[model samples]
Target: MRHLIPLLFLAACASTQDPPRGPSLPDTCGAGDYSYLVGQPARALERVLIMEELRIIRPQTMVTMDYRAGRINFKISDQDIITDVTCG
Candidate 1:
């Protein structure tokens, strides 16, 4: 009986689908779509809406070399402005 309870709990926690979040992200990152954000203040990104992962890179910030598909990268210049948008 104890095993049955644990098995049931596992089943309830198993999920193979996107949560209630609106839509699934694309297979590849789309940097161009966010090009408009360039020249904007980095703080603006905090209020930006997105479904994919966002990585904010500031000047001299050490980041991982590993690239992940569908991940958006925002590079901030020393002036705190968004200098570039790339998909990693």
Candidate 2:
């Protein structure tokens, strides 16, 4: 198993590197352009169409930890205000 351990170590080392920049960025999902949406009423988004996978996360809501490429997350506060706009 000595030979296998070294190969596994190298594999683990490669995985430690930062992931490549992809369409998960704010611009990719157009979340950056919508930064102004923060602090506004969450209902304001109803008129804005983000032609990608959109998710609205409310307070105390349970969400999947899985990162979905090009997904835009709109976080809402308990008072129905937009808190954060980010890409997944």
Candidates in order: C-alpha RMSD to true structure: 14.1, 8.3
Candidate 1 Cα misplacement greater than 4 A, ranges? 1-27
lDDT of 1 at 27: 39
Cα error, candidate 2, residue 31 (Å): 1.1
In Å, residue 1's CA in model 1 sits off its true spot by 98
TM-score of 1: 0.64
Local distance difference test, each candidate = 0.86, 0.87
Writing each residue's lDDT as its tens digit, candidate 2 over 1-88 gives 9799999988887866688887544366778888999999998999997778989999888999998768899999999999999888
lDDT of 2: 0.87
Report residue 26 deviation for candidate 2 (angstroms): 6.2
Clashing residue pairs, candidate 1?
none
For model 1, state the Cα shift of residue 11 in Å: 73
TM values, all candidates: 0.64, 0.66
